[model samples]
Target: MKTTIPVAVAFVAGVVLVVSFFFDEGTWVGGISQEFKIWMTIVGGFTILLGAVSITRVNWSAVQRKKEGWPYKLLTLISIFVMAIPSVLPNTWSPLFGRDVGSIYDWLFTYLDSPMMATMFATLAFYIASAAYRAFRARTAESTVLLVTATVVMLWRVPMGEAFLNMFPGDIPNWLNTYVMNGANLAVQRGIIIGAALGAASMSLRIILGIERTYMGKG
Candidate 1:
C-alpha cells in the first residue's frame, strides 16, 4: 500500500505536468499543477517553522544562562521574526508591521542575501579547479580523455580563457560550448532533475505510509 500510493501520485502528477508543458491548450491541467505546487509551498512553510523554533529555543536558553554572546543570539531571533512575520502576512494590507514591510524583505534579498550567496558560489570555482587539477592526471587512456574534456570545457567557458591560448587555430572554444559542452551540460541537468523527482516521490511515499514516523508526535 505504501509503495503503491506514492507510485500513483508520482505517475499522475508527473504525467500531468509533462502534458501541461507540451499541450498548453487546457487551463485544467495547468491549474492542477499550480495547486499542487501551492500545497507543497505551504508544507515547506510549516517545516521552516520547526527550524525557526529550534533556533529561537537555543538562543533564548543562552540568554537565560547569561552566555557571553547571548545578546547577539537575541538580536538574531529579532531579525528572523522581523523578516519572517511580514512575508507570512496573508496579504500586503495585513497589519504585520510598518506599511512597507514587504519592501524591506525584498531589499534584504536583493542587496544583502544575493551578494552573500554569490560570493559563496564564486569561491567554489577555485576549489573545483584545484580539485580537478589534482584528481585529473592523465595516467590512463580514459583519464587522458576525461582530462582533455574537462580542461577544454573549463577554458572555453570564459572570454579571457579563450584569449589566453594562442594554439587554438580555429573557433574551437566557441564550437565546444555551442555544441559539445552545452549538450553534455543539458543532458546532466535533465538527468539530475529526473533523479530529484523520483527521490521526492519515494520520500512522499514513506511519509504517506507512516513509515516516516519522524514527523509524528512522540508515542
Candidate 2:
C-alpha cells in the first residue's frame, strides 16, 4: 500500500506536468501544475532540513564513540551550528544575527568559505597538470592530434603564447578560436546535450509508467 501510493502520486504528477506544457497558463491543468510546483518547492525545503538532521546525527554519533578523526567530526558539528544558528535568528534581535551583508553567516561565507574554496581549487591545478601530462602522450595518431590541438589551445589562452602563435605565417590564434573552439567544441557539446535530454526523457517515461522501481529502493 505504501509503495503503491507513492508510485501513483509520481505517475499523476508527472502526467499533469507534461500535459500542462501543452495548455495555456489560465487553463485548469496549468493552474494545477503551478500549484504542484509550489508544493514541490515546499517539499524541497523539508528535504534540506532532513539532510541537516541526518548530518548532525552521524557526526554526533562519531563524536560520542570517540572514533578516529572524532576531532574533525566535532569541528564539523561546531562549524555547522556556528554558520546555521545565527542565519536562522531574527534580524530584529541583532544586526549580526541574520543572513544580511554584515551578518555572521554572510561574513563567514565571504571571508572564510570563499578563500578556502579558492585555495583548494588552486592546489588542484598541480594535479590537473600531472593528469594532462599523462593524457597528452602521443602514443597513436589520434593521441598525437589531441596533444597538438591541446598545446595550441593552451598556448592561445596566454599573452606570451599568443605572441608565439603570431610568430607563425598566418592567423593561427584566430583559426583555433574559430574552428577548434566554436566549430568542433560547440558541435560536440550540442550532441552531448541532445543525447542527455533523450536519456532523461526515456528515464522519466519509465518512471511515470512504473517500469522503474529502482527509485522506490527495489531492483
Candidate 3:
C-alpha cells in the first residue's frame, strides 16, 4: 500500500509530462507540466538538504565513535560549517565582519579550494595517462585501429606532430584526425546517446507499469 500510491503518482506524472511535450502550450496539460517542473525544482532543493543532513549524521557518528579517518570526517564537518555560516549571515553583518570580499569563506574557497581542485585534476591527468598507456595495446585489429587513431589525434594537436607531418609531402595526418574525430567518432557518440535514451525510456516504462519493483525497495 505504501509503495502503490507513490508508484501510481509517478506513472501519472510521467505520462502527463510526456504528453505535455506534444500538446499545445496553451493547453491545461501543458500548464500542469509547467507546475510539475516548478515542483521538481523545489523537490531538488529539499533533496540537497536531505543529503546534507545524511552526511552530517554519518560524519558525527564516525567522530563520536573515533572511527578510522574520523579526523578527516571531522575536518569535513568543520569545513562545511565554515563555508555555510558566512553565506547565511545577514548582509549588514557580513560587511561588518569582512564577509564580503576577503571573508574567511571567500579566502578559503579562492586560495584553498582552487588549489585543491587544480592539484586533484593534475593528479588525475597522470592517472589518465597511465590508463591510456596500459589500454593502448595493438593486440587485435580494433585495438590496433584505436591505438593508431588516438596516436594520430594526439600528435596532430601538438606542434611536433605538425612538424613531423610537414616533413612528409601531403597533410594526411591533419585530414585523418579531422575526419575521424568529426565524422566517425561523432557518429559513434550519437549512436551511444540514442542507445542510452532508448534504455532510459524502457526503464521509465517499466517503472510506470509497476514492473520495476526494485525502485520500491523490492528485489
Q: Highest TM-score: give the candidate number.
A: 2
lDDT of 2 by residue, 158-207 (tens): 99999999999989999999999999999999999999999999999999
Error of 3 at 214 (Å): 2.4
For model 1 the local lDDT of residue 217 reads 38
Model 1 misplacement above 4 A: 1-43, 66-72, 82-111, 125-143, 163-171, 182-219
Kindly provide the TM-score of model 2 when superposed on the true structure, using C-alpha atoms: 0.95
Pull out the clashing pairs in model 1.
none
Per-residue lDDT over 1-219 for candidate 1, one digit per residue giving the tens place of the 0 to 100 score: 765565566557656665677655448877887877788799899888899999999999998998999889988888887777766555546544343545656666667778989999999999988987687699999989878887777676776777864366877877787767578777988899999999987876665544554544322
CA shift of 100, model 3, Å: 6.8
lDDT of 3 by residue, 1-219 (tens): 798898888888889899999998799999999999999999999998899899999999999999999999999999988887785676576552335677776787789988999999899889989998787689999989988888877787788987777788778676766788778999999999999999999999988878887976886
lDDT of prediction 2: 0.95
TM-score list, all predictions: 0.55, 0.95, 0.88
Off by over 4 Å in 2: none
Q: How close is candidate 3 to the true structure, as a TM-score?
A: 0.88
**What's model 2's lDDT at 28?**
99
**Candidate lDDT values, in order:** 0.74, 0.95, 0.85
